[model samples]
Target: MAIDFVRSLRGHPVRPPASGIARRTSFWQRMHVDPWLLGMLLVLMCSGLAVLYSASGENVHVVTAQAIRFGVAWAVMLVLAQFSPATLMRWALPAYLAGLVMLVAVEILGDVGMGAQRWLVIPGVVRFQPSEMMKIAMPMMVAAWLSRHELPPNWRALAGCALLIALPVGLIARQPDLGTSLLVAAAAVFVILLAGLSWRFIGVMVALAGAALPLLWMNMHNYQRQRVLTFLDPESDPLGAGWNIIQSTTAIGSGGVWGKGWLEGTQSQLEFLPERHTDFIVAVLGEEFGLVGMLAFLLLYLLIVARGLWLAGAAQDTFGRLLGGGIMLTFFIYVFVNIGMVSGILPVVGVPLPLVSYGGTSSVTLMAGFGILMAVNAHRRLLPR
Candidate 1:
């Protein structure tokens, strides 16, 4: 067979048949994978594992467990990517509804942890946060709704969107998880903005938000209010409300141009830095990897965001475009909030550092959003022959 093929190719440059070429091209689309996006995610994931090992005090068990979670999350992302855009759109409402029910369940049946009722448990079966589900569902819900309606939504559409956003957000606030509530609301708002919300309407909403601040302040929990105040003047209660920010800033600042070297930061290694492995993992990365490593990691994240937005634009349908944009922008918000929180520029609301932060549900949710982006990209209309 080899000799015959070699003889057949004599006197002409061999070329793959057009069908074979298409088969090669369509393999990626068939599998619903985006190579560039996947490559970036892998870099972040691997970098996260290295940083996590140091942050967790070089504990094998901690690293192993995180590795397991990444495994599961990676599988979930690929599974989500296998669906087409229409199927995803069809799923949007039901998933949103299911997420709402889960939020309500968290209110009644959830376990209390730290200071919030955020986790739902089934004894040895499984335990997870319900609000994380909203991270994906919110954008899906709003995008599906907006895709069916006009651009720059009308009053009725806006009201419908608000109602959709408020249900889960209200339930989450009752859980008193301000961090999650803000993220969920942010996801929904991004979708609405992508629906081509008008500038005049945007200004009006901004003014309304400004007016609502007082009411919001009045409604905040005492601890929540303290967070805001502490953000303004952290040293006022150095040992109490201020410890986290103080310690975090110290860790980042002490890093200098080049870090103290991996696992060498006194704040984290000495247990002075709060939530070192989770919400403030950035401080760990900053301390060990220094300015160069932090800059490289940030550039990688920005590339992922840029690519995600480009995929959204490449999507032929309105639903894919809006949903994809919503997911990507919300992802950027997560990175911003977590880094800002740890750096003391924003109040610590317990937001984690995207894939780098240690957590099962959060990591999975972030990956699943990328999966949706993959699906949108893969299922796009093929070009004419």
Candidate 2:
């Protein structure tokens, strides 16, 4: 099956060389399962399991749970990929509204974990981070809203879009999950940018954002501020706020050129690196596989991003293009922020490393985004005039 899929991707007709050969590409092709994209995702998931096993102190249970989560996420991706772009767009506004209601519910009656009220649990049923839904909903909402109007939206339209972006972002930030708020905000902004908002307005917004930094800093929680301070001078409080970064950098540096070998990272093995199974998993990868491994992982990520952008560009309608582009950019932000914080280049904001990190919410949310990307690609031909 894999061989035939690869051949089909390469533009060869899927045929048996002998007589009585049956072709099998139609279903997958109809479902819009881009072999390259699916292959990359599988590779990342496999590598994630390997790193996660080592990070979890060789815990079989942890790896099993992660594998199960990936299975669910993959199923979701396949199902979502089967939808046409128009079908997705039709659901956009409702999804956004439902997400907003969930966010509001969180504000009123959410569960607190790790000092943040970010999850809403239904009695004996399900619990999830509403903010994760925003990661997809914001872009879809913005894209749909913008698509209804003109290209290069005027200042009035931009203001409406800003309001659309701001509502959930503000709600998430109030939950004090700054990392997610920023990610959701960035996704919506990407949709606006792709919609061709005028450069003049963009410049003014940028300048305003620069000026607002001080005010934004003032509003941040003390711990958030401490993260920034710790990022600047981790040595200032080596035993306190700086411990995670110090250990992460140490793990990365000790890996040298070729790494210490799989499951042999002293930092993670010795339990010196915090969150080794989650946000700081990259450090585990760096320690176990070194620069070579990190680069290889990044190359896979690059291919996914490139393909996402290509799908966005190829999309026949404004909504598909904006939504696809937004998802791609948001995914990039997740990778950049995770790698940056792990490397001590960016302040810690608790953003997980997409698929490679051991987390259920982010994994599902990210894969769903990819599913939408696939939908955009697959359903482009069916887009309405």
How well is each residue in 1-385 modelled by candidate 1, as lDDT tens digits?
A: 3543475668555556656653346566667888899999999999999999989988889888888999999999999998889999999999999999999899888999988999999999889999999999999999999999988789999899999999999999888988889899999999999888789999999999999999999999999999999999999999999999998898888898889998788888988888899999999988887888789889999999999999999999899999999999999999999889888999889899988888999989999999999989887744322
Q: Give the C-alpha lDDT of model 2.
A: 0.91
lDDT of 2 by residue, 239-314 (tens): 9999999999999989988999999999999999999999999999999899999999999999989988997899
Q: What RMSD does each model have against the real structure?
A: 6.7, 6.5
> Which predicted model would earn the best TM-score?
1
Q: Poorest 10 consecutive residues of model 1 by lDDT?
A: 15-24
With a 3 Å backbone cut-off (N, CA, C), the pairs that clash in candidate 2 are none
After TM-score superposition, what is the CA distance of residue 338 in candidate 2 from its true location, in Å?
A: 0.4
lDDT of each: 0.90, 0.91
Model 1 misplaced regions, further than 4 Å: 1-23, 381-385
